[model samples]
Target: MEEMMRSELVSMSSYCRRYGHLKLHDFSNPSFKKTKYSPTKVFVVSSSSSNSTSPPPLPQNPIFQSFFFPVTPSPIIPYLQHCSRNTKKRKFTPSSSSGSVKVISREAFNAAVKKPSVAVKKPTVAVKKPTVAVKKPIVDVNKPTVAVTHDRGVRKSSSWVKSRLLGKGGYGSVYLATSKDGRYKTERAIKTAELSRASSLMDERRILKRLKSPFVIYCYGDEIVREGTSDCYNLILEYCSGQCLADVIEDNQGGLSEFDVKLYAKDVLSGLSYIHDRNIVHCDIKPDNLLLTPVDHRFRSNGFLTKIGDFGLAMEKGSVEYGNGCGHKRGTTRYMAPELIGHGVIDFAVDIWAFGCSVLEMLTGVQVWGEHGDLVYDDWVSLIGHSDLIPNIPSWLSEEAKDFLKRCFVKEPNARWGINELLNHPFLSSNQVFSHNGFIYE
Candidate 1:
């Protein structure tokens, strides 16, 4: 039995070296029949007959014991499979055997190889978590929404929404607004000032309230607005849809027409007459303060309405006592009168001086001292004396108009024409009748 075993191993080794990839199954035990494993074939090289050729000599006893006897079925089968796929043949010199070499046929080796044995484990199904339902939030429709209230303890008026800023001054800013309560047009202006500077706006509000004329800016009322953490005062006034007289003068080629000048002069004098009768003096009177109403093309010949605005510097006559000739010279430099610069007696005559300079700008397109530097009392005197030297004064201007301006430009405030007197002047009264024939009057 040992000699036969040696002969079988020698033939198997020879075949393994040639077709090294062939696998050898263990059939010595009955447990392999029921066990599970991958199926594979044990290949054998072709031999004519077992008795024809001698089997190769077996390797040394140590090499033989290490290669076959000690190896278990698990490792030897895998080694056989690995060697079966590798086609390279290994050279082996077997030891000399006593008995004749018995060659193993291909059919005999294949019939001896048994099927593989390995059991496969079945896969398991994972357990899933149970599902839970969620609840939705519910709201009541009968509940009233809370209105945002300010800290001033007064409810905000829904009448107007203040929007973009139109301008800014020493007190605060003026914003363009839209009316929500139909109290006024969507386009209106709102002036605001904090309590720190609210005194000026409050004074202007009082002055505007006392006066009501087509030649004056209209006022709505005063309201408190919450600006950040503090309260602000808002003085809502009429919005002038037209440009200022300063812009009007700039647009006209060589200044306004003589007829236009006369019409505007009449309007300004009318406003001044109304205010002067009330003992109020508009301390600041300049082209910028005179605003023209929107032009009405249907009555285009009548032109636009002119009104005196910006009463910030106005004061009632004889209200504030002027002593020591130290009154505040609060007005534009170009339109300030000689008496005003000297800190002399200030009265309605100051407005008359500014009005004269404004008229000159209308007819001549130039300020009184625009050509002269730092308008001194002497320069003013020389300016009125040489009236022809001034540019933009039409040669056709009536002598009555020149004389009217001369009275307004007088050095003595007492001798200047009163607002009422200027209304009856030939330059204004005569121009009114001539306007019927044509728009332009020489």
Candidate 2:
């Protein structure tokens, strides 16, 4: 029995060595029983069993049966061949009925070992920017190019007719306009200029609309008239039948009496006080701009009313252009105040200075600076800007008149008297009464 067992063990060892790819364990080793692999049924062949009449009875022990199974080569041979062809790790599962091993494929093993798949990200697309439309400014035809208070209704061109040309100047032409339907009992004066050159007229219209006084010329409204092929801007105003103060002075050939001067001064000062109270400065004040309208006998006998006009160079108080020498050339050089010509300083005081110059011109039929004949523009600027120079007052005038003129010609505008103070001066504040028809002035 021991010899037969030795021979069978030697035969199994030789078969394992022949098929080394199968990696079969040596059954003769003691550690083979203690391996982690589960117990599997294997078939063994004896070296001396080819022609035996009957196979030896198989082992009856279960442990020996697991290692040496007497099975035909058909089933076990094919399974071993498939396992030898594969390269992946092998897993064994014991068959319940036959106690045989089953082989797992490389594809099945890879599927079990695969990691969880990651989500794929989509590609980004480019976006476009939108275009914007630019808008142009819209201009209203009815609106004046320069802004002003239009308290009165606008008059149409067909509402009035131009009877004749009254005068013309840098501002344009003045016409005697009569209402076609006689809506206005008195004739209306219309100052017209080309649209491009009507800014000063528009400014005058703006200033006049806010001022309401018997001494200040009235402004009805304004309109745009088409003349020939060009458009013209028109300022509707109150017409004065009598001549301007400059014309009156010329006709007289000499200065008027103190009584007439006093009356005119009171009227002009009243208008100046009205405008100055409203924070307006008349940069240009002269005799040519004053209108004398003859009053009816019922109101006053042989009396004429004085109205201030031509506000083309007027400006609001504290405006940036007020004293910055903006309209210096347009303003009468002789009437410019010392502060205005020297340092571009201006205010209500400058108007007082100009008023003094206007009064001096009224006392004498000649211009205030007419004595300096043919002096160029720069020389006049130098002369007016001089600190020591002042307008000459006539020696023949009364002490009150000379003193009144002195108050207006002060070199320092701060020291010069205001309209309120001048109105209270003895020259204008006379106790003597003058009565003509029913009109009385004291």
Candidate 3:
């Protein structure tokens, strides 16, 4: 009986493959792409006659089609196959119903994705709750928002036209939309994380809301979108017509000099200092996050108008300490700090560490670490010693750059000077231009 059943299962699986591609109504839904769902396959599961009293024929199930295919499971698989062929005998009834498939609902099938027998590893994800206690941003009572949103900050309807997709990010999608009157237009960036929820993301929203600086993108709104048990949220923002620092330098070929670089760095540090004073940590800081505006009279007053953008990886002070069990690791790996590698407690200096890397790139036309820049962190570390951690400094870079780097990239986070002090440094205060190729920073 067992052998017969095994053969039946194997045969049924094979039958499914024949018509598996036949058009079946909506079914299979890949959770990541929520809108694009795929339904389960339908197969002929009935016998030839409607009145036939015989057992129901297990029409080849497309779901189990993999088993029907000719596959040598393994070295041991050969032995099992031989034994099964010799010992097992099964009977199968043919079905006459037109071949069709049913796509299993995600609710039922999400339980055992891929196949049976494969043990799945459960991930640790935060179950974020909506904070009714928190107040919404102060929008003009007169300027209309989505109706009924004034109470709980929840949109009464999905009237927010996706508008044009401004940009797609790792966590969320961005769109460009104007107010109902076209008087105010802002860039709406939605943040999403596959492995986790957006509870920890409020740090960015909170920081952006308080900021009223020309160097920071103004956040216009915040809301959450939920699917099943998982919920995703986004931050609506004021659009900036500008190029990123990464693109600016790349287009400039190599790196920008002491003057333009310093100007960019100053504005960037000014933004960072503001974030620090507000008790926030911009954990993921890089040239790409820096936005450069078009030569407008307002910004032409300042050299390269650099503004800090994207705070998806930010955290509050002391949140990622050495002993904390948050297991939260976020930041660009190339520009990441040594302490943030794999499993280590990190501090605000981690931001400084990344800034040191960025400044080094500004000075030299290369990444502090990574391809087209330095590929290995150890090489840079070896070149620039962890002097504060050691009695004396390592010998590779000039005393000037080395000393400045040591002050910022301190091994211990607490002793590091905050962004304000770094801004006050002589290196940034001077109107200097280190030559690059033959063109000076005009």
Q: Candidate 2: lDDT of 291? A: 90
- By TM-score, the best candidate is 2
Best by lDDT: 2
lDDT of 1 at 265: 88
Candidate 2 residues 1-442, lDDT tens each? 6676666666656644443212234334222123222223333233232332323333354444345533323344444555756754555443445422355666787887895677777777667667677786564332336334243332234356889998899899999988877555668899999878998898888688889999999989887766777767888899988878888888877787777888788889999999988888888888888898888656544468889998888877655545453444446777888877766666788888888888877887778877777676678778887658888888988899999999998998889999989999999997988876567766
Q: Write the per-residue lDDT of candidate 3 for residues 55-106, one digit (tens) a residue.
A: 3334544433333332322333344444656753433434345432233445
Cα deviation at 313, candidate 2, in Å, is 0.7
User: Model 2: how large is the Cα RMSD against the reference?
Assistant: 16.3
Error of 1 at 416 (Å): 0.7
Cα deviation of 220, candidate 3, in Å: 1.0
Candidate 3 vs. truth: CA RMSD? 35.9
**Per-residue lDDT of 245 in model 2:** 82
Candidate 1 stretches with Cα past 4 Å from truth are 1-159, 163-165, 182-186, 295-302, 320-326, 373-397, 431-442
Superposed Cα deviation of residue 337, candidate 1 (Å): 1.8
